[model samples]
Target: MNIMSPPPRKLGRIHVPAVTLAHGGGGKAMKDLIDDVFVSAFATDTPRALEDQARFDLAALAAHGDRLAFTTDSFVVDPLFFPGGDIGKLAVFGTVNDLAVGGAKPLYLSCAVVIEEGLKIEELRRVAQSMAAAARRAGVTIVTGDTKVVQRGACDKLFITTTGVGVIPAGVELAIGGIRPGDGILVNGLLGDHGAAILAARGDLALETEIESDCAPLHGLIDAVLKAAPATRTIRDATRGGIATVLNEMAEASGVAIEIDEAATPLREEVRGFCEILGLDPLYLANEGKIVLAVPPAEIQAALAAMRAHPLGACAMLVGHAHAGEQGRVTIQTAFGGKRIVDMLVGEQLPRIC
Candidate 1:
């Protein structure tokens, strides 16, 4: 017996490889890219929701020590560099915040390094060393890692993937769900500082200011807040999508309405002016170090005091509350006293700004 051969289409001239907008678009090309390259190496039992986040079990960590908390994030800022943070510092802080906001004491990280060919060895050393310093500052260890070198231009200078492991005490039953009507909403510090700082570093627009990325590990500050009020239900550090998107998502997930007081939202005088001129909303911009807290009414004052005592949270302020009405939506009482919707950003407002 013999098998018939299938006809073959002639192969087209080799497609010159380049990074393009389509690679980041959540479409056919993006899926193909992830499947062909990234995901195969990082596959897990978890569903690949491809969301800004994913959820997993933390109960197992209770047996290990206390409560289990696990999370992963990857950083791909355009320059592999930025003001106040390179891809390295951002990598560390990103993982740290994820674990801390989940009510875990971040203990370690599994770092995966992908370095493209022709990357400066000095810069590479700097990145690694900076990561070491950052992890140490956060009291975390880089317990294990893998490194890969792709052909030059296959990646943007460098990309870092960090998966973190931590343990929240079992007594802490924090949930984004705990946000309730009349509860206080607060931010640890200023908004838009991190986003604006990175934008200025890009040198795209000539607007000049002393802005800098608010990239910092929040483990200590988070601990401070939790100690004062273990009843603090939900906490998230505004990162890629900014405070606006974060609040919207939190409200939707928790089935509550988040109403923020714009006049109470903290912003540096210069930051506000910059946003007005650039046609940017400070709320829609990214932040690296700040946290948004949903806490009990009685604990509001205590939470704010704990946050402000920390260097990283010196400007903590109450901004809003989760309310009974307007199910799963976020509204801000504008500084003008008018109400407007605050929704998840439809697209990246300031890409590469974090």
Candidate 2:
């Protein structure tokens, strides 16, 4: 005779004030923490049943595109909370942007977080909620995840690793090597906001200003650009190494020289002042919500207009162009009408700014 398995047990809620080693012991405590903090927050998008892996309909994914895009990133920012975002929000958008830059429609993500033993349960809950909110804004789902609690001092308060899966529609090919001479380079908005904000938030500089991290999801803006400028060559988010690094990589990949106008590059007054005070070059600073794109000269106007129409690209500017010169070289035309080479970053500018 066949026998049926018992129904799944109801999820349990955690009553503890802080996490402990027992919560990672793979017992009731661990279940409680996951149920109370993670599952509940992601309930709307994820399956109710707790499975080892998330399953998706192949046909459903195929309907969106002809190819799949996968990307993963980890967030270990020193301060879990920041001026405009926290580690959780950063984890979601960071991975989403990675896939979006590849000309994909981000659909699903897997979040794995390592929590310190003494972290407050309330703080963990807040982070979980933030991830959920970010996923909603990006039109993606946190389908599955893992949580592990470690002893105090073994890890930071929390670190999140997110892996994303997306669909790249047919005829949407974007690559670094696709950049060509005479291509127009464009950027969404001001640079160095994220790097400057993190520096000021640390309180070590004794400097104060109203600068907030430009941490945001850019898939919507990207979609708009592609629709308008179908012949766009390449795109990259100016994250850790900023626009200077991105430009250099593009130049190297396409075997072309890129020249950017310093006056044409957008920079907020606060960020400029922060860089000047710290003796930092804003060009090499970090940004979380900015993108640098190369568009064919024929479609440059259409691309710029489409970007400016989007909320995220209202301040978008065509900062430079790609041309034939020294292979893999990037230069900047200063506001004072002088030119200089823009080299790759030598070392970490601001550790843990992302």
Candidate 3:
């Protein structure tokens, strides 16, 4: 009998472990994954059956009936080390911004670590120290945690998952679906820098400028804007799928069509050059430390003024507006005045992007 050749040592058609494309397609795949992973990971002692947001006993939270905000994320970006920040800083900024963008004053964070065997303890210390420093800057604390170790290759160098809790004052409310026709869409400065910086560091290709990731914490900027104009109805950090996907989310949630001016969305010169060279849309690239805001037509000026005062918001600009529709469509006008539909992104990160 002829010996069977070891299945030709090769790469698979696709890489990375993730739910199917339909997972982000708003289907059973999405719901099941949320129910299984998200609820299970977070709802150990709390009820997992029903609730739009996690329900907590306020009796223990503080004195008065204060509104509570909770947010969580997993950091698994390649190269625990990156240009502007690392996994540690990302852990803190990522969660702090989540709370801040939603109009909440962040209070505390819970960090969990999964480490690979054979990793250096000193490296672990450095990441942890960075986390401590970041938490201090964000004015939050790492209140609790759990640690787990796996055999080498069973995990990456490290992975950090953080959950944040904050309180929102009365009269302050924002929702993804809060977008409306005539509402102005604004984005805080320079897109694609964070994502492209990571790609460049991989050294797979050479580019003109040695760019740095725009990874940052946006709490300060958000704080300034909300203070100036309380009418800000929505805030979203343009992560995962970037501005286009985020705008699409706004359109769906508010049941309105969003119209964006391609020329108005800001892109750094190097970022624009790299995206153009590689045929990528600056709109769909991820940003670690940026924000997208939707506010009333009348409050646009105040919003801009407030944002411009904060260093992070200096480059902020109005990027779009909403229109009447079945509540979930997004359109963008090209520089030449052509209209195009912006769809939700699907599949493993295309284009070695952020």
Candidate 1 vs candidate 3: the lDDT winner is 1
TM-score of 3: 0.81
Model 3, residue 349: C-alpha shift (Å) = 2.5
Name the top TM-score candidate. 2
lDDT for each of the candidates?
0.78, 0.93, 0.77
Each prediction's Cα RMSD?
Answer: 11.3, 2.1, 14.1
How well is each residue in 175-294 modelled by candidate 1, as lDDT tens digits? Answer: 877788888998999998888888777777676556778899998898899999778989988988889988987888788998998999999887899889889989988899988989
TM-score of each: 0.81, 0.96, 0.81
Error of 3 at 19 (Å): 30
19 in model 2: Cα distance from truth in Å?
1.1
Candidate with top lDDT is 2
Evaluated against the true structure, the overall lDDT of model 2 is 0.93
What candidate 3 gets wrong by more than 4 Å, as runs, is 1-65, 350-354
